[model samples]
Target chain A: MIRAHGYAAQNAKSPLVPFTFERRDPGDHDVVIEILYCGICHSDIHQVRNEWGNSTYPMVPGHEIVGRVSARGKGVTKFREGDLVGVGCFVDSCRECGSCKEGEEQFCTGGATFTYNGTERDGKTPTFGGYSSVLVTNEDYVLRVPEGLDLAAVAPLLCAGITTYSPLRRWKASQGQRVGVVGLGGLGHMGVKFAASFGCEVTVISTSARKEADARRLGASHFLVSTDPSAMAKAMGSFDFILDTVSASHDINALLGLLRRDGTLVLVGAPDKPLEIAAMGLIFGRKTIAGSLIGGIRETQEMLDYCGEKGIVSDVEVIPMQQVDAAYDRTVKGDVRYRFSIDMKSLST
Target chain B: MIRAHGYAAQNAKSPLVPFTFERRDPGDHDVVIEILYCGICHSDIHQVRNEWGNSTYPMVPGHEIVGRVSARGKGVTKFREGDLVGVGCFVDSCRECGSCKEGEEQFCTGGATFTYNGTERDGKTPTFGGYSSVLVTNEDYVLRVPEGLDLAAVAPLLCAGITTYSPLRRWKASQGQRVGVVGLGGLGHMGVKFAASFGCEVTVISTSARKEADARRLGASHFLVSTDPSAMAKAMGSFDFILDTVSASHDINALLGLLRRDGTLVLVGAPDKPLEIAAMGLIFGRKTIAGSLIGGIRETQEMLDYCGEKGIVSDVEVIPMQQVDAAYDRTVKGDVRYRFSIDMKSLST
Candidate 1:
């Protein structure tokens, strides 16, 4: 067994604190990663607080993990010592399910083994996430981090980045298309980058007019203040696609109104409350409202490659491991410019 | 001007009563049709009662009309006297819009001239629907009714049939797919027939167990009682496409769970309230909830052709024009077998 030290929440209401745990010894098909960075995701907060009602504790919650491969078991031929790799939301999923076979393991029928706050395939062993100093995972689940990108900034790509990328790709957002990214937070920022990099005319739709300059700086060609009724009315039925990234409850019908005929609004954010959608909005324009999770392994690697090629990395605020609780609060308040990545070296200090 | 007589709702609170009106004489591009039958739609009730808040007084409500060409203007080359034809939800649309040019005139950017209770393109003349003795329509908006089908039964095809068929066709429902149809009304019944005729393994999902035998008689191979928890549990993640036709509000989330990964739930019914949807359901499975209005004129023609070839027609209860009020009440209580087609001859009587 490998000794692992990380932050954990003893219960739903408790703040995370230092804790010690063990990971299984590297199996024949497994590789051990010395964690370098872990990006905090909104889901981590949801799980830690048991907001979803399915959480278990003490839970070490992190999934957007970036690290250096420290050891490889004999049968692991994919990576050797010191290779930079990433682990996203899930660590393992049943390989035989249709979704798994189709490379969409996020929808695995047997239930995916979440990186944290979830059980392994055996249904008895608890899994710890990448707030830890090390992780043991099968080579198949490991993604090769492309060269020449800031690793800390790349950590959130596993979650926020892929969550936005998968939908853009699926919806065929491309050159000459008008794309709108709703919200200007972690997920929306990446959406703008991806859509802009794809040669689309990107527009940032937000409640705050303050984000206009920042959105333009992030490669958006237009910014529409969603709170402005006249602006919204002028932009109605204009977008080919709208990537909605707001996690807070908002008016989805108004967003649906922004789509042209046959246009789509893809929801990447999981709002706690159910959305109120008028069928007429969709029916009149023949519009669609779809949702997507983080991409599959192959797609995640593709996203990383695309980001590397486009020089696109998350706009992140790096912090020490001790500041995660504060960062979580800040994230809830939308104070962070984008994402927060915990530098794992802070654990040693 | 041509004299016409039929049932009209004098005001929102009133029932249909005999009313006289006049239609413009056939112009160069027009074909005048003597009405044979008109199918009652649930929307007719909504419009008559001002449920949508857009109703006009003295409204002649019906769109599903099948009749014979009574006269053709000089420039009307598509039809001659005695030719069987049908007119659906709309009578005219701006021909220059993208939707109109693509034959999706129903979504005309300049606003489609609905068969009834809508203003014509000139923006002042009120258009009447098929409940009357005769209708004058442009050749472009008329459809050829194929030979050998019951014209009265085919009346419902103009509205209810096209409403359901468009979504099924758009979703690419075909052989080897599992299709589920919700409810057993005018729209749901058509959805089952279309999906089943498309060589799919069809399942009828309904709240009533009594619908099982009727659903099978409509060519469905499987019937699942939606009210049965165990049945719903067993059928979860089972369908590739579910054509939801329940206009009255119900649990959309539960129906969304019945689709497999990448599956879609298409809504043709317009529930009065906005549907409540959990984003996680759509995100985790890559599922979609989409709305479709009636198909384009081209597609509607194709649907009619397909129905003719397959000998498919709505299972309808024929009634006199005076029984429309009773039919509406029965339709509301789910007492009708599928649809109510009023014989226009009774209007003259």
Candidate 2:
């Protein structure tokens, strides 16, 4: 067993506090990583507060993980000491499932083992996440972090980045195509950067007029205030695709109207309530509403390489490990520029 | 003007009554037809009773039409005198829009002229559907009713047939694929036939256990009662595509669960209220919920040709024009075996 230390919430209503735990001994295919940075995903808050109802207590919540390979078991061939890598929302999946065989481990039929607040395949061993000082993961689940990108900024790519990139790529967002990014938060910001870098005409649709400048700064070519009916009506049936990254409950039907015939509205954010969708909005135009999670490992690696080539990185606010509780509150208030990356080095203090 | 007689609903509360109307004389690009059979659609009842809240008074509701060309203007080359033809849903469309240019005239940006309860391109002339004794349509919008098929039984093919066929073709529901058909009604029955003939493993998912035998007779290899929790649970993630033909508001999430990874649930029927869909159901497996209206003219013709080759025609109960009112009530009660086709010749009596 390897001794590890990190912050954990003892219960649903409690703030995270420093705690000590033990990680499993490295197996033949395992690589031990020294955690470098961990990004705060909205899901972390949801799980910490038991908002999803299935959260386990004494949970160390973080999935947007980036680290250096500190050690590797004898059978691990993918990495050596000091190689930068990442572990996203999941750490293990049943490789025999159709989804896993196809390299889409995120949709594993046997249920992928989430980074935290979830049990291992044995159904007894609890898995701790990247909020800790070290992580032991199978080489198959590890992703090679591309060189020349800010390691801290790259952390969120494990979650927010791939969540947006997968849909854009799947839907074939490309040059001359009009793409709309709904909201300007963690996921939306990445959607804008990716869509723009892909040579698409990008528009940011948001209820906040104040996000216009920030959205433009993030590569959006146009800004449409969703609250303004005239603006929404004017842009109706103009977009080829719309990436809906808003996690808060909102009207999807209005967004459905902005897509042209055969267009799609891809949802990446997980809202608590079900969406209200008018059949006519989709039927008349033969439109689609689809959902995507963090991409497959192969696609995630492609996203990282693409980001490295395009010099695209998430706009993030770096915070000390001790300030995570404050960061969570601020995140709830939408104060972060885009994402919050915890400087794991502060854990040593 | 050509005098035509048919049944029309004068108001939302009124029953269909005998009424007289006029159709325009054949234009240079037009073909005039003597109506033979017109199939009763669920929408016909909805429109007559103003259930959709968009019905126009004195509306002649019918779109599933089969007829014989009585005359063709000088410039009409597609059909000649005595040629069997059919028209569905729309009489004309603005051929300039992107959807129209792509042969998806059903989604015409300038709005396709509906067969009834809608105005023509001029935005003033009311277009009467096949409920009348005669119809004048442009050559482009008319379809050739393939030989060796019962014309009366082919009426429903215009609406219900294309509505189901379009999605199956678009989604590539073909050989070796597992396709599920929800609701064993007009559209569902066609979906079963099309999918089965396309060489897919077809399953009929319905609330009633009694539909099992009928579904099997319609070429379904399997029948799963949707109302049975154990059956639904066992069939989870079992389908590649599900053609949802249910017009009534039902749980879309449950149907979504039956689809495999990257699967789709295509909705052809328009429910009155918005549907409730959980984002997790779609996001986790990269599933899609899409909508499809009736096919465009080109595809409709293709469907007709395909059906001709397969020796396929809708299972319909022929009725006199006077029985339309009673038929509408029976349709609402789900009492029809499959479809009701009105014999337009009864109008003259």
Candidate 3:
């Protein structure tokens, strides 16, 4: 075991604090990563506070991990020392399942081993996430970070990026298609960027007109104020696809009304409460509402390469490791401009 | 004007009574049909009682219409005198919108002219449905009744049959695919027959185990009582597509859980109230919830042709026109074998 130090929440009710732990030494086909920047995901707050009712403590909550290959076992042919890489929401999965065999490990039938607050493949070892100093993961689960992108800005791509990209690619949101991005936070911002990069007519739909300028700056050609009835009515049956990224409960029926015939609405952010959907809204026009999780390892690597080619990176605010608690509070309040990528080296600052 | 006689609902609280009305004479594009059989739909009750909140007084409520072409205008080349024909839900549409252009007149932008309780394109001429003795319809909206099937059993195909068949083909339910049919009513029975004919592994999910033998007789290879928790738990994540034919509000989340990754659940039924859906249910497996109305006219014709080839017709209980009230009561109580096709000739009996 290798001695490690990082921040952790001892329990659901407590704030995260500096803690010491041990990570397993590199096994064959395992690579040890020196954590560089980790993005604070909304799910991190949800898990750390036991909002989802399944938190294991001494939980080091982070999944949007960006790091450097510090060490590799002899059998690790994928990554060399100092190669930049990423570990998203999961560390490993049962490779024998249909999902894993199809390269969609995120939906592995045998259950995926999550990055933190989750047990490893051995079922006895607790996995610590990238909020820590280092992480040792199987080489197959690691994604290669493409060159010429801000490493800090690339952190949220592990979660928000793939969460948005997977559904967009899966649904075939292509050129000349009208796409709506609901919410203006972490996931929505990336949805706008990607939809725009894909040559789609991207519209940012939000509750406030104040976000209009920022939405336009983020590549949105149109800004729809959802609170305005006339605006919503005017946009009804117009969009080909809508990416709903708002984690808070909202009128999904109203959003469903916005889709044209046979259009789809994909949800990336999940609210705890059940959403009320009018079946007529879907039935009359043959509309669809679907949900997507983060991308698989192969898809994640593809997303990274695509981002590198398109020069697309999340708009992130860099924060020190000590400011994680504050970042979590702001993230809950929807006060952040976009995402907050934690500088792991700031443990000494 | 052509004279017509049928049972009509004068108001929401009243039962059907004998009433006389008139229909337009056959125009250049119109065919005059002498009604033979009309299916009693669940929606017929919903509309007569104003449960859908859009009923017009003295309304003749039925769309599952089968008839013989008694006369045709000079320009009507599609049908000849004495030809068997049928008309489904709509008589005409704007013929201009993308939906109309694509042959999906059911979703016409200007609204399709519903067979009953709706206005024609002029927006003032009220329309009546198939409970009447005679109906005048354009050739485009009329379907050819393929020869060699029980004519009475073909009535429900105009509405219930096409409603179920549309979504199955739209979702590409094919050979060896596992398809689940929820509720064993008018729509569900056809779903089972079609899915079975398509060489799919068909499972009929019903609230009552009493329907099992009937379900299998209707072509279901398996019957799983949805009320049984153990049976449901064992079938988790097992289906590729589930045709939800239940109009009553049910545990949509539970049904969503039955889908495998990338699986879809299509709803053809519309319960009045909003449905509660857990985003987690759809997100975890990347499942989909979609709504599909009845098929396009072209597709409805295709379904009719396919049924003709397969020797398929709905299992229907033929009832006299005077028994419509009792049929409606029995339909609400789930007492019918499948559908109730009203014998229009019984109006004189």
TM-score of chain B, candidates 1 onward in order: 0.99, 0.99, 0.99
Candidate 3's DockQ? 0.92
lDDT of 2 by residue, B1-349 (tens): 8899998999999999998988889999999999999999999998899887988878898999999999989999889899999999998999998889989999988999999999999998887888889999999999999988999899999999999999999999999999999999988999999999999999999998999999999999999998899999999999999999998999899999999989999999888889989999998789999999999999999999999999988989999999998999999988887999999999988
In angstroms, the error of model 2 at A148 is 1.6
Number of clashes recorded per candidate? 0, 0, 0
Q: Write the per-residue lDDT of candidate 3 for residues B81-104, one digit (tens) a residue.
A: 999999999999999999999999
Q: Classify candidate 3 by CAPRI docking class.
A: high
Each prediction's whole-model lDDT (CA): 0.93, 0.93, 0.94
lDDT by residue for model 3 (A1-349), tens: 8877899999988999999899989999999999999999999999999998989888998999999999999999999999999999999999999999999999989899999989999897888998988999999999999878999999999999999999999999999999999999999999999999999999999998999999999999999999999999999999999999998999999999999999999999898899999999999999999999998999999999999899899999999989999999999999998999999989766
- lDDT score of residue A320 within candidate 2: 89
Candidate 2 — which pairs collide?
none
Error of 2 at A311 (Å): 1.8
Isolated chain A TM-score, each model: 0.99, 0.99, 0.99
Relative to the true structure, candidate 2 reaches a TM of: 0.98
Docking class of 1: high
